[model samples]
Target: MISTVVWGTGNVGRAAIRAVDAHPALKLTAVLVHNPDKVGRDAGQLCGLTHELGITATDDIDAVLAAGPTAVVYAASGDIRPDEALADITRAISAGAVVVTPALYPLYDQRNAPPEFRDPVLAAVADGGGSLFVSGVDPGWGNDVLPLLISGLGTTIDAIRCQEIFDYSTYDQEDSVRYLVGMGQPMDYQPLMLVETVPTMVWGGQIRLMARALGVQLDEIRETSDRRPLDATVSTRTMGEFAAGTQGAVRFEVQGIVQGEPRIVIEHVTRIHPSCAPDWPAPPGGGDGAHRVVIEGRPRIEVTVEATDEGENRSAGGNATAVGRLVGAIDWLVGAEPGLYDALDIPLRPAVGKLGRKQS
Candidate 1:
């Protein structure tokens, strides 16, 4: 079994702990946390499991690395503290632990990933013989694997579009929903996520990756967005009190142009309230959320994936899938030569091994 460590204890981190414990080929060794209160807690408690795993959460990074873990699942949020997250991943890789994370945004498509971020990771891998893989939902399987896989079913292809439609009220991330994404904010408030070039910086790589896979040259990448305000005051279960006229919903598209036409598209329909945008595309059966891929071509295929966590929470379910993708890759990364890898380089099938089966 590959001895593994899970770093961070937030949404993704909690999911990682559960995934590592349940996987047959992986051994849960340690959990790392930054919060002092979380230190010394059982990994199970952090993840809401009934029983405890033997592993305890630690703040001492050097101690954990010195213990000789084969892989480290870096689930820490790089959304706000990106520099620190990169440093943490770099340190782990340089200490000889294979690192997989959804944290490093640019590395989602390593080929187009910026040199400043990519260079250090490569040097660290060469120096310490560790491998790295970076991926997540929108830029992860939702675009790279799912879209391409569906396109194969069509006799001919005209356009491929991947969409994430969700209601964010149930999502517990107040910071991201309120501030970063500008939900429940004034109409004039510009979210950091939708700001100029930020979308390109974050998701443009997915466009490039898909175009490369389809053997199409993109003329350019373009971003467009629309926002709506809450019609009336509304209160959510977790994030309470969104006043009327505040930003309630957002829809955006990142398009990849091929031969002067947009052929590869990534779209997001995120709403704080269900009633905010009645006309926008929604999850089937009015479900909380889903990831969809539409191949607008011969046979005209469309696929939707819905996932739920322990409490039927779609947000948690999405996080769990991201965690699975990273954790399940541990064994393969351990066996492979040291290098930085993208979703295009990794196989989707191996990551499904030893999953949802009784542990031996």
Candidate 2:
């Protein structure tokens, strides 16, 4: 069994713990957390399971690395403290741990990554003989593997569009929703997330990844964004009040142009409240959220995936799938030579031996 460590105990971290524990070939060894209150908590409690898993959370990073764990799931939030997250990950990699994470946006497409982001991690892998895989749903399997796999069904393909439609009010992240994305804020308040080139910096790699897989040379990448204001003030259960005329929904796309046309597209329909954007595409059955792929081709194929976890939260469901993709890859990375990898290199294998199984 590959001894595994889960770093961070947030939304993504909770799912990572559960995924690692349930996997057949993985051993849950430790969990690292930044909060002192979480330090001695059982893994089960941290991840919402009723019973303890006999593993305690720790803030001692050096001790965790000294244990020489074979793998680690870095589920910490990199949105705010990206450099620190990178430091934590590189430190772990240099200790010879096969690390996988949804953090690190620049490395999502390793080949296209900037030298500054690429060089240090490569040096780390060489120093300690470890491998790294970076991926998530938006710039992750939703675009990389899912679209590429489904595009195969088309006799002739046109544009490949991957979409994430979600209602973020149920999403637990308040500051991110209100401040970063400008939800519930006045239209004049420009969000840092939607600033020029930020969308390109984030989702542009996914466009490149799909283009490479399809063997299409991208002439350039493009970005398009639209925002809508709430018609009336609103109040959410988790977050308090959203004033009338405040920003409520956002739609953006990063498009890959090939031969003067967009060949691959990654679109997001994110709404703070369901009633915010009526015309924008929404989750099927008007549920919380979904990841969808629309392949404009001979078969006109479309696929929608909806996942719910942690008390039927769609956001948690998406996080769990991201964890599934990363955690399921631990055993494979253990056997492969230490290096860097991406969604393109990592095969999306089904749950081979996990069916009808009971968790320990």
Candidate 3:
């Protein structure tokens, strides 16, 4: 069994702990948390599971790495503190622990990642003979594995489109919703996520990954965005209120152009409230959110994945899928050579031996 450490205990980290506990090939070692109150809590209980996982949570990073974990699941939030996330992940890798995470966006396609982000990670991998892989839902499999797999059914391909349609009203991250996404803010306020070139910085790597897999040369990548205002003031159960004329919905596309035409695209249609954008694409199954792929070809195939957890919370459901992808690869990485890996390098393996396992 690969002894593993789960860092961070927020939205993503909670799911990681549960996943590691359930995986037969993985051994849960330690959990690191930022909240002082969370320290010294049982790992499973901290994540809302009824049974104790026999491991406890701590805030000491030095102690975690000192144990010489075979692998680490770095599930901390990188949205606000990417630099700190990078430093932490690098430190884990430098200590000879294979690390997998959804934190770093650039390293999703580490080959084309900026030198500033990729260089330091490579050095860490070299220094301690450890491996690293960075990916999440949209930049994870939504745009890469799911689309590529669905495209196989097509004969003549025109354009491949991957979409994430989500309703953020029930999403628990209020700061990310109100300020970072400019949801309750005035229409004039541009959220940090939807600003110029920022979409490219985040989702652009997935486009490049898809293009490379299809053996197509991209001329360039481009972006198009649109925002809609709430028709009126809206109150959500989790987030207090969204004033009328405030930013309600956001739609954007990151396009990979081939032969001067956009052949590969990654699009997101996010709404603070369901009533925000009626015209924009919404979730297909009428859930909180979904990751969809549209293959425009002779067959014109489309696939939608709607996952919900923690009482049908789509955000938590999505986080669980990401945790499954990253945690499931620990055994494989433990046996492989120490190096940086990407989505293409990792195969989406099936739950081969988990058929009859008891719930944690």
Candidate 4:
């Protein structure tokens, strides 16, 4: 049944077209939208998806690739414009489809990309025979595939630290306060603006996919940032309505090394005002919007992930666990393995449902 389209209606392209309109092996088949006031309309009410699935919304990318969809998720516009979004993902993989993207910085850190945009997206997915995968949820699963799947339960690992503290006070205020915490005024300020190189253009490919799955080989990559303010006002019903102390709080740290030794460290903290960390305290049975993973020496491991939601949307628990792991990796990104894959080559199991399920 494959047949999917879903380009961009925003917010992970309307949650990946309501997860391909409630996947049953998938088939929503169209909804492009470059915003001519939301093209033709109902892609389930331009993504409120309350009922109808007649599938509308189009800006005509050759009539939605001649209405022949086998794959195309490209959740457009995260801003950095990786060469005009890899030239629209190489024209939707040369019109044959099969392209999945979360587009925030091409392939994260594909060997410090810029070989004119990673050799033309790896020669347009090998001359568009098709197949491409990129993940989400913080460099696709809290810094590259959950630290290579916790170093496969370790044999003799040394380091890997990933932490993502949340509470953006229910994001969306122009994408969490004017493009992710830049907030108002100051000539659209800049200073570690969400950690320079723009959050490593979205996870510096999770530090080169954890140095190519722990084989470890890296020479350079460094970034650091910290900001605190929001000592008061922060509100969100739909990422707006602020008052208390205005808003401002952002932190990012990414460190990955091999030859010089620091293994990996990725940290992202966003707080538009929410506290608890009287200087590092809540361990030993963590809770309250918790997401933690710490692995250091041999036989030492700790993982605490708790954030679930269903209704009155209090930041719907990190957008339903980052849109249910990017909608269950859309059928293994339509038979993956082309070039560039993260979230540890994608396999957290339970895609359309399961894995902390709650979205009916």
Candidate 5:
């Protein structure tokens, strides 16, 4: 079995730990955490997976590296310490561990990232004689993989757009609300909120990734965001955060250009208001919710992915999907060609069937 170590103990990190535990071909060797409260605790318990895997969490990266694991999954916070996480990946790679991460920033959108962070990451992997790859549902697959999948059906394309719409009523408020809908005192406190440089970092790379896969060289890319309030309070008892009414909605649209000409347009919408779903009614299939992807132009494809769980746990569905993908790739990532890679660089086949197979 391929030994693996996971960095971080947050939502994504815990999810990665669970994925590592369940995979037959991979082993959860160690977990790295920065929080003093979390260090030395059972990895499984940290993620609510008590009685599953018995590995403990530690803060020592070098000690974990000395254990001889072949890979490390970097799931640390993308907002606060992205640079530090990148540094950790650099150290792990230097210690001969292949690195895969779900950190938010980085080069998910090459056009939006600072060269200081991006260039060093690439250089570190090359210097360490190891490889690195990063992915997650939104930037990883929703925008990047979905558009690329649709492109496979078209002979010629005019524009490509991918959207993810879901109720944020169940998400962790402190962690996701401000970043997603800009919640504080007034609805407009952070007016033009989602339009900031930070949000752009998440989806920008996906646009570039799709453009490159379609063989389109983008000359320039531009982004815009919109928000509106809700009619009734949306509450998450688990997170203890509520909005008197829908606080606002946020949408990001990136237009891609090729040779001074527009080629593809990618848009992402996150809304706190309920009115946004008037025409496209929310899927009543239950659970947290689902998202629809509608691709226009040659070989048109319309698909909807529904959530399978309910309430605060709705994220479990998407988290499980991401975890399974990460775990399934352990073998290939550890031994394949080294360098930074996105989902587009890897084949979609052979993904773990636990979450359900990808639709054709």
Candidate 6:
């Protein structure tokens, strides 16, 4: 079994722990945390499980690395702390641990990643002969493999649009929703996630990755955004409150122009309240969130993926799926060449063997 450590204890981190424990080919060796209070707690308890996994959470990164796990599932939030997240992942790679994560956005498409972010990861892989795979819902299966696979069924394709439509009130990440995304902030407030060139930096790679997979080159990439304000004061179960006229919903698209038309697109329609943007697209089945793939082509294919955790938490469910995708690849990555790999390089079947072994 491959010894693995799950770093971070956020939504994704918790899901990673569950995934690692459930995988027959993986052994949950350690869980690294940044919060002091979380240290010394059982891994299972940290993830809301009733039983213990016999592994304790630790805040010491050096100590976990010293254990020399074969792999590290870095699930830390890189949105607000990109530098630290990059350093943590690179160090793991340099320590000869195959690192897989959804943290680093730039590394999502390593082929087109900037030198500043790509060079260090490549160097670390070369120095320690370890591999790295970065993927998630957006830069991950949602945009790359899912769309490409659907396109194969089409006799003629006109456009491919990947969308993530969700209500963020159930999502418990306060810092991300309030600060990074400006959920309750005024319309004039600039969110870090949707800032100039940031959307391109985040989802643009996915556009390029998909274009490359489909054997097409984009003429150019473009970004468009629209925001809606709350019609009235509203309260959420997790987040406190949002006053009227504040930013409540956001819709944006990252388009890959081909043949002078926006052929490949990644669109996000996110709202803190369901009533905020009734005109915008909603998730199928009227769920809290979903990842959708729409192909405007001969076959006219449409695919929607909804994730729900044990408690019907859509946000956690989405996070768990992302974690599963990353952890399920550990076995494959262990035997593969040591280098930066994209979703196209890793088959969608990595989760095949682990399917039947899912924990109840």
What C-alpha lDDT do the candidate models reach, one value each? 0.88, 0.90, 0.89, 0.65, 0.65, 0.89
Name the regions of candidate 6 deviating beyond 4 angstroms.
137-139, 350-360
Model 5's lDDT to the true fold?
Answer: 0.65
Q: List pairs with backbone clashes in candidate 6.
A: none
Candidate 5 local lDDT, 212-300, one digit each (tens) = 77777778777666555655556554455445543545555766767775556656555443454444445445434555566676667
TM-score, per-candidate, Cα-based? 0.97, 0.98, 0.97, 0.32, 0.85, 0.97
Stretches of model 3 off by over 4 angstroms after superposition: none
Better of 1 and 2 by lDDT: 2
Q: Write the per-residue lDDT of candidate 1 for residues 1-360, one digit (tens) a residue.
A: 898999988888888899999887889999999999999999999988888887889999999999888899998899888889889998999989999999888888898889988999998998888889998754278878889888889999999999999889898779999999999899999999999888887888888989988899999999999999999999999999999999999999999999898899999999998999999999998878889999998989999998898689887888888777777778878888899998778878664555456532
Error of 5 at 312 (Å): 8.5
lDDT of 6 by residue, 32-57 (tens): 99999998999999997878899999
Which model, 1 or 3, shows the larger TM-score? 3
- Residue 22 shift from truth in candidate 5, angstroms: 1.7
The residue-by-residue lDDT of candidate 2 on 37-120, one tens digit each, is 999989999999878999999999999999999999998888877789888999999999999998888888899998888999
- Candidate 2 root-mean-square deviation in Å: 1.2
TM-score of 3: 0.97
